[model samples]
Target: MLRSLVRALSGEVDPEIEARVRAVSQGVNELGFDKWGFSPDAVKHAMGLYAWLYREYFRVEAFGVEHVPPGRALLIGNHSSQLAYDGIMVATALLLEADPPRAVKAMIEKFFQHQPFVNVMMARSGQLTGLPQNALRLLQEDQLVMVFPEGARGGGKTVWERYELKRFGHGFMRLALEARAPIVPFGFIGGEEACPSLVDVKPLARLLGMPYLPITPTILPLPLPAKCSVYFGRPLVFDGRGDEEDAVIEGYVEEVRSSIGALIERGLSERRGIFFG
Candidate 1:
């Protein structure tokens, strides 16, 4: 019955898209649910909606998606637009544009887990809790995992602070080292302009148990139709055991951050305008 509902919600899926999504590894059980709650059917159903946003609304242009090497890989990208559309676009590009469609297991913030029904949606859509253990397990299984090192700091960026990367957390770097997975740094441009924020209301956010409440020109941070670009760089490999010293881990984190910064700069230079692509 539930499966029927999912299919009904999906309506008619493109046969080519259905084939590509089925090609990705999902590891579901008889009931079509993976141990982590991923459902290939659910992912397929979601592709149509996100694909429209990727192709039409945002008009996202992705480059170097081929850099996403097969097997275990860590995708690191900047997070913004309060709503996390950047992550969606990045994941969509990998699924729709990569040579072989790959499912991205995004590491999600704990704050979102508390929202009503959000946990179920996130799991069914192939997202996992942002825990080191979960990410490690995915990497060990040769799955592609996506992480945003900037966390809430980057998500709360105001218009004035757009494109400026906040301090990165070193956990992703250490995780990559431990899993022996290559890190692919990608930069997402235009999120700030899409959902420009003027200020973050910390007091309100605290009252609501939210990370930060952003005040945008539209009052809500709904994304405007902004042309966005995502640039994927070559894979980066670091030498060290995952348990390196804090200083060593910090250095490695800095290198990845710099790579993403450079990618962002490149995307900015290539872009003609916010809404003009």
Candidate 2:
């Protein structure tokens, strides 16, 4: 049924991508849901749906995909594009490009739960609620968890603020320390140009209970075809107890933030043009 639904939504599912997705070890139950609500079927469907955007539309160039180590790992990334397409692209790359493909379990905002169908789709597609416990549990289970330390602030950036990472929260650092997971910092470029926000309507966002209400030239959240690039860095491990002073934790967070920032700069230097690179 899910395959049929996926075929209906996207008539073009790459055979190689399909084989790679099936090779992933999600450990789902008979009903197709893992303990944390991951459905292999749903993930495959999502891959089919987003594969086009990742390929023909955005023409995403993924570098250092092999940097993602096996077993437990924390993927820290810079977030942008109000719609969170950066996360989607990163996940897609890991699933399609990595050797012995991995299905990344991304931590998402709780605010999305209020939306109707979007909520269910997210959970089934292996996205977890952005809570400390959820992230810790996934790490303990040896799953690859993607986290955006900048949270909604990074996602709501205006065009001018693009690639300039917002202040990163220290919670992810604490989780990594606790789980003994290696951190893979990555940077995503071109989302800001894809859906550049001219301004954020504060009053409207407050009323709607959203992070930010962006006003773009499109007037909608649709992303333009901007050449996207994701640069994955080597895994970083910090040695310490998870229970550390606030200042100590902040240092780890800063290190990861700086690494992501450097990646962004590298991508910028290599980019030939926003729409062509």
Misplaced by over 4 Å in model 1 are 1-10, 219-221
Which lDDT values do the candidates have, in the order given?
A: 0.88, 0.87
* Per-residue lDDT of model 2, residues 1-277, tens digit only: 4554456376565677768877874577889787877777777766776776787778999999989999999999998688878889999889888898988999998889778998898888888789999999999988899999888898888988888989998989989999999999999998889988999898999899998888988756578888999999999999887999998988888899989999999999999999985
Error of 2 at 10 (Å): 4.0
Task: Give the clashing residue pairs of candidate 1, or none.
Answer: none
In terms of lDDT, model 2 sits at: 0.87
Listed per candidate, the RMSD to the true structure in angstroms reads: 3.9, 3.2
Clashing pairs in 2: none
Candidate 1 Cα deviation (angstroms), residue 206: 1.6
- Residue lDDT tens for model 1, 49-148: 7777787778899999989999999999898577878888998998899988888999989998877787888888889889999999999999999999
Candidate 1 overall lDDT versus native: 0.88
